[model samples]
Target: MLNQANHDTDDAAPLDMLEAYFAAHGWEHSRSDEEIVASVKGSWTTYELRALWREEDGVLQLLAFPDIKVTDDRRAGVYEAIGLVNEQLWLGHFELWSSSGTLLYRHAALVDGGEEAELSLSAAELIVDSAVDECERFYPVFQFVLWGGKSPKEALAAALIETQGEA
Candidate 1:
């Protein structure tokens, strides 16, 4: 049962760390199961939902099972992996909170022409509100955007991987 009562102020450090790791090792979103499910329903077939991606070092790391969706922003569908020209991009999307969480406050090349579409501030705000509500009573959230455009890994890594002065 996927409840909507969890997801709040997420840990910025770890998420950033993960982003860096992913940057060094490229990771991305997988394709849609909808196409296959379109023809069948209730028929149990073993399928793994993953983001078929390659590592920065040119190594292919196939994570068998992954969590990807297009539901409400707070419901984990917020982080979507769409394809654009010559690259796979992670949506400038989010999973934030009422108080605080992972809201792409300032988008820097957040969109990659075709891969990432423009998500209005209104929509972004909605995601923050909903995610905050989800984890309001529980604990803070844990967000991690794996990939995006060119040098996406590096930029994300820089954002997350803490420095001396900045947290």
Candidate 2:
């Protein structure tokens, strides 16, 4: 069980599971927030930034596929923030539903790559704060920051939710 106020767990839960999964399949990729943001800087447009679906071989796929690593301890908070940021971006009602029916409203921020990452501290905070301010405008839930670069949780959580999502 998880307390609403805090998600204090002894283990990273989904992170540990996803880490093993990625390592087994060789899909793990690591980069600081800076590296990711930089990769997408010039390429980031409104559609790209708030993409709800992914294209594979020109085929449209759900947003929840494609393994993405997320840092742990920030799971719940991060998804909550995604919703906030979505609203901020005016992307419309975006939500990701897990198989267990645990509805998670989130956004997929694809951080590209570059030197900009090494020199930008405020950009990192801006990424998070902007989401919070936007989501706070409508939803009361505090933001959850499951940073994939910082923790392995994002990939793990996504995988688990997918198992249940298909149900």
Clashes of 1: 10
lDDT string, candidate 2, 1-167, tens digits: 12213323322222222232223334433323111111111111111121121222221111221122234444455465444445445432345443332322243333323211121223323433343333333222221133234222343343234233543
Weakest 10 consecutive residues of candidate 2 by summed lDDT: 38-47
Best-fitting candidate, measured by lDDT? Answer: 2
Model 1: residues with Cα > 4 Å off, grouped in runs: 1-116, 138-167
Off by over 4 Å in 2: 1-88, 91-93, 114-119, 140-167
- RMSD of each predicted structure: 20.3, 18.9
Q: How big is the positional error of residue 97 in model 2, measured in Å on the Cα after superposition?
A: 1.2
Q: Compute each candidate's TM-score over C-alphas.
A: 0.17, 0.26
lDDT of 1 at 34: 15
